[model samples]
Target: MSALNTSVLRPAGFILMGFPGIEHLQHWLSIPFTVLYITALVGNSTIILVVKFEQHLHTPMYVFLSMLAFVDIGLCTAVLPKILEILWLNSKDISFEGCFIQMFFIYMFVTLESSILVMMAYDRYVAICNPLRYTTILSKTLVCKAFVAFFIRDLVLTGLIPTLASRLPYCSSVCISHCYCDHMAVAKLACTNIIMNNYYGLFVALSILGVDAIFVGFSYIMIFRAVLKLGSKGARLKALNTCGSHLFVIMYFYIISLFNYLVYRFGKDVPVHVHVVFGVLYLLIPPVLNPMVYAVRTKEIRHAFLRHFLPRKIDSDLSHR
Candidate 1:
């Protein structure tokens, strides 16, 4: 019994199902997934490079934006390679250690993203509510400190879920039903009692995502209030416009995540493919859209992009003329 239990606890590996019910479609699905991965890589990398090289973009807001791009890159990179392999090559085997490592990084990147969003909200709040002190409040030193705080806070908090999960005695089937290593999904495969895992996962999810969302919402409310008190219509529009990208990002991240959580918790009757598809969407969509949202919606980013990419075209056109 003891040897049997040990063997069960430490299985060889897990088989990740890319898209369970639609195996035939995985090749087709890989096309879009590959496109999204490339887009996220190129887009976020461009943002980071722009923020790094452009002197005018050395401000706190752009600094945070660059950090967000960095996070998106990490988030997508953590999951996409394995996903693409599973989809395109049918290589779904992941060692237990590999699975835990992936789980850790995925959760870490997600937590960092949530923290960055909260910091962005605070940055906006300070900029709009106290423009005079904005520079003083979110100085380079403060931004550095905020970055450290975000890393440490999320590292400690979100790490708990994956850490506890890794320690669990997984005595059941060594198969995960989704593309990547989701904490809840993996934990659910344990044959032993998983009430602790479930409760703790819920706690961490709420503490990070739920609390961050509430704070972000509150920050926006304050921003709206400040905008309303502005005497001119143009001022209100300008303020709201500054927030448009961040607000859209916040909505995009949280809404899909919330829906995924709901389906995970309550949609047992729903089709497995639906859950898998939504899971993929939840992970992939933000990374693909975030940079686009910022670039298209933020005037500075648009200007920077145009300045970076259009000059060569313009010079070519001039030479032709």
Candidate 2:
């Protein structure tokens, strides 16, 4: 028995069927996807560079934004290049190892983003709820510690999902209906029952996302209470303004993620193309939008971007005009 090959059979690889129903439109679809990918890359890279070089913006909030931009870059880069390859070059084969690697990074970046958002909420809570101690509380050392803690938490939690999925005996078809190695999409191909994997994925997802949502919502509630207690209307508005962008980002992210989760779980009748497109967007949209949201809503980022990127002559011309 020891000499009888005991290892389970694994698929040679997975074929990423990108937008299965719309094969004719894939060439056209690649145009928009390419634009979004490029935009996400440039926008996030700009945010990171601006924050790093601009000393005036070296506060806790900007630091967290920079971290978010970095993660956003990773999140999109993990999936888009392969997606573009499938769309543009008709290359769709992802090695088993490559698929697992992509799955791990996708989960890691997502969970890490959740933790960072919580940290951002906490940062706002401190800024609004306890202004005097903001500097002392979120000091350089503590920020470093928070990043490490978030990274470790996500590493352990997100790492388990792909690890569990990878262990399944995938002795069946290897065609993944979606563009990337989505957790459930891959799980469904296992010849064995995936009830535990299904529930575990849900549990871990809810634990990270659900818990993050509740905490962020609570922090905002506390922030509002503090804002109301302020003596000046200007102070109240300023506090609310500070939180508006972060809150919008949270709502946008959660809404799409929760919808996608629900559809995957319950929307059996939902068209595969619809689900796939949303899945792609769920991962892609945030990276493309986060920097735009911050730049549009936050004056410091806007001014800094103009200062660094806009031509001096044009800036002076605009000012003069």
Candidate 3:
């Protein structure tokens, strides 16, 4: 065998896939990203704390909501700090390994979040369609089993891409055209012909986003039908109210996801703002928005938020004084 090379594949120049001139505008981003980062951390984290802290939230809906919070936290951590550093410090530098790791967690957390939404849809369907059998249908045992299965499936699907990615020979243009290590963007720069890789990535992407979209669609159909059967305009509105929050959050993510892939992946000459802003929003916005939607739109989570965290806030101020 030939001698093994030991050089680390850190890119030489500004090979970032984001908006350029961060050096000039980077200062402006600090305040906004800092505020966003902190808000997302506190909000998403509170969702988790509330669900776990309150006894009333020991049901399937809250369990998956907690899982959604967990996913939000993970995705936020995966993308935000590096982005903040790049923006604030004028450093668009990320090593290949760091990029790879970030890509893995981003994909994994995204998959988990999507799966949790699927679970939530199912939970909503049962609650609305089979009220008497909700608990029996979604028991602790069944939920645990489903969680385990979802976790494993997400882990496997996302992990496969990174494994394949690590082995590919990448060109020196380490400029990933997005803020994070979007698999498609990275794949585009690989020196090797990536038919199989593209196929696999497409399969996995469609599987998570596509399949979940279908599930959400079908569930809503059944839900709407059931609501029609009830024959109460008020009940129909309430049923729709229960769904609006998730619908907005889901539509936003998928639309951005489709836009990212379509504009960058298919169409060349992607704008810099699309890379920096859209990529950041792709991961962080949902976390920030999802919790707000849950708190403001969904009553139970709002009450749980009040019960678990509100008094702590009151006590903290009292203690500080």
List the candidates' TM-scores in order: 0.92, 0.91, 0.87
Model 2, span 1-321: residue lDDT tens: 532323334666889998889889999999999999999999999999989989999999999999999999999999999999999999999998899999999989888888888998899899878999999999999999988987887898889888989888876688899999999888888888988888877887788888998999999999989888999999888867767766887878877776776777788999989989888887899999888877557889878887778869557979898
Clashes of each: 0, 0, 3
Top candidate on TM-score is 1
* Tens-digit lDDT track of model 1 for 1-321: 999888789787898988889888999999999999999999999999888878999998898889999999999899999999998889999998899999899889888888898988999899889999998998889888878987898898778877888888887788899999988789888877888887777777787888889999999999999888999999888877767666887877887776676677778898888888887786788888888877567878877776787878757867999
Winner of 1 and 3 under TM-score: 1
Judge candidate 3 at residue 138 and give its lDDT.
Answer: 97
Candidate 2, RMSD to the unseen true structure: 2.6
Please list all clashing residue pairs in model 1, or write none if there are none.
Answer: none
TM-score of 2: 0.91
Best by lDDT: 2
Ranking by TM-score: 1, 2, 3
Q: Can you list the residue pairs that collide in candidate 2?
A: none
